[model samples]
Target chain A: MDLSLSTRNVSGPGGDRTVVEVGGEIDVYTAPKLREQLVELVNDGSYHLVVDMEGVDFLDSTGLGVLVGGLKRVRAHEGSLRLVCNQERILKIFRITRLTKVFPIHTTVDEAVAATD
Target chain B: MATVELRFSAQPEHVRTARLVAAAVARRAGVDEAVLDEVRLAVGEACSRAVGLHRSHGITAPVKVVLTEEEKNFSIEVGDGVTGTGGGAGNGGDAASGGSDGASSGDLYEGDAEGEDEMGLAVISGLVDDVEVTTGDDGGVIRMSWPTTPAVTMP
Candidate 1:
């Protein structure tokens, strides 16, 4: 299916960061898209990505891989990637995988962006 | 913009393939990064559920996935046999209570409180905004819809 993806730029205490708003279910099928976007952003010299998952309804291992992979890529370039997830289901995955400690997770995009700065 | 339909064998490997195709389609459609990840998660859960159901019943037909991108909704339809309805409640244990907490220890069917770690219909229902299950003369179909506008780059 055509999963809806929304993108915006947010500026705050964290300086300038790209906020990627995800609204839909994420799985192995769609993880590549996110990976590609992260790669492109890295190539363009844009780091500090904040993925807003408040609107996301679902996420799987492959989806988790994409996030972890992005974190690795961003860190390699001396950049950082954070997540803003509110859904219990999505958050549960992060908490279970102990990935919450890996990436800086915030309650909202504002908090994540602010923290990045 | 356009819809992509794919039919694949009822195997774990094909499920991965479906996710790959779905991701490619979403990227070509200009979907953002985080959003695309969710789509993949949902699709994987759905396909895995279908595989488990089919395996239980011994049906050897390719599972069909129709990925359609409408004006304001992105929808996925995954179907199996004429009556792929049962086994819905088995996974409901995970929903009623988030008990497991995410511990993938050995096989889930052993002695876990929240049944097994079978992430299928329950996972999809948890992730998607709207889930429609239809059973009739045709067959059983699961339709998942997400209400959000895609990030389309215009020329």
Candidate 2:
């Protein structure tokens, strides 16, 4: 079975940041695609990234790993990675992993793109 | 109790099937959307762990998933039928040591450093009401359950 998850690059709220909007279930099978996309973005010199997770229905550890890997990749280049997640379930995963304190999570792309630190 | 059992190859693609069936069962059991989401994620986590373990151990056995509904509770058990490689089961033992509630944060993300990757057991522990891991002669089994009724009071 194929999850309906897709990731595409879009302009952020401020029209400066790169935003990746992801939709559908992100499990072990689909996470690699997101990972590849994030790696490709980082390799292309796109540093500041905002992942919009409002359309994500489900997320497992594999998905979380991809996000963490992306963060590390961007951080190595002195860049920042932000996440836009408002769903209780999606936020719960971050909280469980104690990653809420590690990553900056915002409720909107506007706030995430505007965050300076 | 209505029970549904499935056995498939220990592959990543099969996790999606397990999650879909588990979600459908939870929805039909009158579980709300929030609880159904938990069920779907928890089942996916379990199946993913089983598949990863089997692959690491070079075991090509099928992973088994069982979904059972009784009263207002829904439970899922995901396991693999491969023979253990002795020390390969150590991780399962550490995970199972968290007991029935499975709320031990250490057991979930034991040695993961910041930005380090780990399994989804901790996420499963947070989403489900109860979690248990058992490693026996057959293989490792992760059992998780959730109540159909919402436990948290919504404002």
* Top-scoring candidate (lDDT): 2
Badly placed stretches (over 4 Å) of model 1 are A1-117, B82-84, B87-118, B148-155
For model 1, residues B40-139, the per-residue Cα lDDT tens digits are: 7667767766665566668898788888877676778887763835445335435323423322321232222123223344455555567776665555
Instruction: Assess candidate 2 and give its lDDT.
Output: 0.72
What's candidate 2's DockQ score?
0.26
Candidates' TM-scores? Answer: 0.50, 0.79
DockQ of each: 0.05, 0.26
lDDT of 2 by residue, B70-95 (tens): 77687788887655423222343333
- In model 2, what is the error at residue B9, expressed in angstroms? 1.1
**First chain of candidate 1, TM-score:** 0.90
